[model samples]
Target: MGNWESRLYSVPPQKLGEFVQNSLRPFEDCQNKIDKTVNTICAVLQEAEQFPLVISVAKGGSYGRKTVLRGNSDGTLVVFASDFEQFQDQTKSPSEILHKIRDVLRVWQLTTELAAQVEVQMVSGTLTIQLSTKRQSITFKVLPAFNALGLSDKPSTWTYLELKRALDQTHSNPGEFSVCFTELQQKFFKNHPRKLKDLILLVKYWYEQCQEKLKYAPLPPVYALELLTVYAWEQGCRTEDFDIVEGIRTVLGLILQQEQLCVYWVINYNFENVTIRNILLSQLRSSRPVILDPADPTNNVSKDKMCWQLLKEEARIWLSSSGLNESPGLSWNVLPAPLYTTPGHLLDKFIKDFLQPNKIFLEQIERAVKIIRTFLQHNCFQHSTTKIQKIVQGGSTAKGTALKNGSDADLVVFPDWLNSYTSQKNERSRVIREIHKQLQACQQKLDLEVKFEISKWKAPRVLSFSLKSKVLNESIDFDVLPAFNVLGHKNSHTAPSPSVYSELIDLYSSSDALGGEFSTCFTELQRNFVISRPTKLKDLIRLVKHWYRQCEKKLKQKGNLPPKYALELLTIYAWEQGSGTTNFNTAEGFRTVLELITKYQQLCIFWTVNYNLEDETMRNFLLTQIQKTRPVILDPAEPTGDVGGGDRWCWHLLAKEATEWMSSLCFKDGTGEPVQAWKVPTVQTPGSCGAGMYPITQEMFSFRICRTLE
Candidate 1:
């Protein structure tokens, strides 16, 4: 009755243990590096173990690591990956991967231990066996789907070439195959161990027979993919993964000089399709762990639409394969998690692990430094030694955040230095504009490939910048804030509104941080982000291309929008959305943010403070929308002017300028009219003023003072 996780582990992969600790690129969280390291470790483990069960067992212990095993227990193991979706709806759980592998191993371990007594009758994708002394033999292999647990079996025929001169090689007993297998298993553990090569050879005859029987006719491209997917097993387990070179050859004729249709052929294609069914029955008979197609969505509204597509496509391709046209099939049923197991979500736990920096995070500090080296080269457009560190903030994956279907990417931009700029609020606007420009160009022209944009966000009068780039097919967003040294406290870094941090994300991305250093395709930070976690996990990583968009104003106003903040939001939404997270649960993680934001509410409020656009001059014009109160995602719940009003902190800071405006203290000499917040005239406060405002100053965009009163 129990499900996959409750079952025992599969065989462990041989850990290559050869990974170099990767550096954390400044853009990446330290914890993410740990996840990557864990995954790589698991990948290596999977790599070393050519056996079917080894992959399942090892990946379960690692993060974002999964092995989808397909093959008969008595035959060879074929390993593939489960989907890596953030909303969980599209993929399998790390824990589930581990549990299934463990269960597979447990069954094999126990079965082999009992081998002396139980006989191994057949070794197809399924296994059959009978008690050594009994007339009946049972065969079993793991099934892809099953509602009930325990055992199931089927009868099959085996005909060997009748020998003329030889003594009887076939056992005389009706169920001798099972008995001999059992005897072999018992002997295997007792001695130092039957060498693994010999164990593999034991199934050689069966492998050939299975392939010969199933080989059929296939179409073109499908045949190529088959060669990529299946032909390697014919060689050795060491060559399991896609050989890009070979894939290129198979798909594009092995010549990189030109992009064209492939000339490759599926010379020795075999059908592992029906064999899968056969193995399923065998696993059932052996009481092996159940296998499930991960793309099927659970009760979670997180649609498997994406995953289902992948499954169907794979199935379709396999069916069209040269040797398996008759076996055309599709998802019959996707069983719910097995019975007698924990109902709690393991991904919830995985996200929970991200709430804070653990010891693994320390490893990333080192990684971050390295990432800086890589990213800095491209980010040097601003030309300062300016460095950035990763800071955690609140936010969410696109899913479950709002009416929007999925979570959007938010990147936190933290600078190592540039305390001076945080002091002056007016300078931030110009700085951010230039930073945005530099980054936009950096991504296109430099090794960093980072494109960025910046725009005005008032209230607390914070600036917003969005960074985007591509890896594979998806666009990645790096939402950032620009601040000076003023806000550099633990948990919150304050800066003058025109801070240097986000500015550098732009500059370095262009000029390699102006050191004009090494050119790079991806900053070390970007690489680690890619390496540490899979962007394909979900669309949370879906966008980051151009910061400029049709809806920039609308996007930032909806949330605080800091990268770190958005990340927290993702975890919260993941909890709510069910890995399948999203659609309606918008405020899922606000409670936690409520506690954390109190300390930085003033700053957060600052982000909300916007200059009034009421334009009392034009009675009830622009004010119409502002006055129409509705529960909107970005709307301040109450007037930001008061503490009880949501976003009050932002109004509080802006109110200082309002008071100055009301007192007629904001008039500047150049405007010849009353101003709100700008350099006060010398006659009013001369000593406090800097050099008179010029038409084209660096702070023109940030402060926006001196204008001809048109």
Candidate 2:
């Protein structure tokens, strides 16, 4: 892994070296502008009587380290103050000092001279000043810190002395005060081999380019990448004469591996001190891809594991390129480019040709639903009052997103015998067993000439079975789930009352704490939410599911993938957030969903049509669920159920697929316009437009023709 020549890649070492040099040559003008701005600011602050006495300002970050890119780059100006004790005493906290410094700078910013020198922008508490020249402008974070330089003269009075004490007792970081050690941090990377610095710049360039394309979530900081490059160089054949191409590949390969990367230097900090040692050890063990700050042991820079995974996903794609494969001569694919261009009618045809289900499959699914419903009705428990209340259809079939080749339906039977959700949970296994028995009886009773494919004996939450028709030469699968009729008893015209959710909250709080535990009880609401969507939106949902299925096939995903239901809900959320209309760009909607998949970490989608925030208990629970973590698409029907779950890897795989698919021709048309979204009337009521939420009898299904099939 350390040898670049041993590893297969499309570009020759010479070619890569040239590309690296051409892309990452540092600009001296940008660095000079930053230096001049720091000098001018320091000079002005020293002259201002109202401001704190200025000691000296120094450059920091990439500029200070001499690893900045040629064009627009970020640098930091560390403003050290003489009145450290007074500033610390007067201010409420260390963070307040930054605000105070920014406030003073804001006053100075209004001055014609200062305004002409730089444009001020306040971020979090730090002041960012952008200095403009004829060619370009460079931004710098103006961090004000207490002078800790030459601490040997006043060892007892040094802020670092007190800061170590404060940090030991209370884990509060001294904020930007850490910038006092900026010179040390910059010095750490300053004297590294010129090749190492260039290698770091190349990695930075790749990261920046990938970031533009993969806007999935917040990426790991640039500092982390620099540190990673440094670690790679130090660990792997440490030499100034090493291949730059090898160095770049090693860095990217490390990112792809995503192993626990814990690297730190003992040059500055000592592990001999127990406090520092413990802190360092804990940070080192914090999370995978852990890169502890060499300057500050307490700060583990690689804590954003998801962001690193996104980077890793990109690396994997680059690593898999045929050009990169271990072959003879150099032959790589062209540079990574955007796949889809314009919003046209590609998505419309995708829906019509691939996504939309055929009439025969829909007919088979309808027949299966009726057979299951009739079986549950006939097998009424003699001991119970209401045997089978109603059989509600769900999943892609009910949501109108069922694919033609491989699709499924969920038929949840609400039994009146089960008093509540709790009862259903406790007795679901028994109910499923009875239904399984009755399914065998129904098969004998109907003798419907449909082939019974499998005979699995076990029945847990859902009774599974398969039916195949000789005429159609196809099979349709069903998972018959038995649930309590909580919502069935309510009035159909009006929404369920607050009491319904309040009772649900109590049930959830008292029941098992596992997510999606009570989804069976809310199958009706879930079906209704999907079935109530507009026709075009349903088509969009189908397209997304098709993409998901493609990912599953392409990735050969064996274990539990992120649930298909989550993707359905996500499509609806995208449509609602984008153009919530029947007539919108299909390609745009598809692109939006794919883009959202990349940003699965920030996904917090839920519907309140059936349930609102008016109910306090339900509202609180709902809020808690939404705030849990990334890919949090709360089950609109069952608040406890998070459909976008299983593992982060599930979403990771999908996000990677979305990234690759975004580069395909499927999204474009002849004129190069991206595929357009479907246009249909906004639908009302559940089970309308052949979404089939309500179980249709054989007669109704035969007569109620759907235009989708036509």
Candidate 2 per-residue lDDT, tens place, 1-710, comes to: 22231232455556666666665664456456656666767676666666556676767887788777766778898867766642243233446546666666667767635322577777666578777655445678877666665443222223334556655455555332456667777878876898888888878877776776666678998898998888777755467877775566667777865654555655666445556554554554345666766665556667667778788887776556554434322221111111121123545764674356567656756775676566567654544565777777877777676765447777787777787867878888888877676566656666444566545866476778776554432455778777777777675334577787787778667766567776776777777777777888888787777677657755664555788888887778777756777787777788778888876766656555666555557656755665556666677777777787635446777777776556444556556555544332221111231222234343433233222112
Best by TM-score: 2
What's the TM-score of every candidate structure? 0.22, 0.46
Highest-lDDT candidate: 2
Q: Positional deviation of 448 in candidate 1, in angstroms?
A: 14
Which residue window of length 10 is worst by lDDT in model 2?
Answer: 330-339
List, residue by residue over 340-423, the lDDT tens digit for candidate 1.
111112222222221111323223323432343344334633476655543322233222121011123333344554344323
Give the range where candidate 1 is weakest over 10 consecutive residues by summed lDDT: 15-24
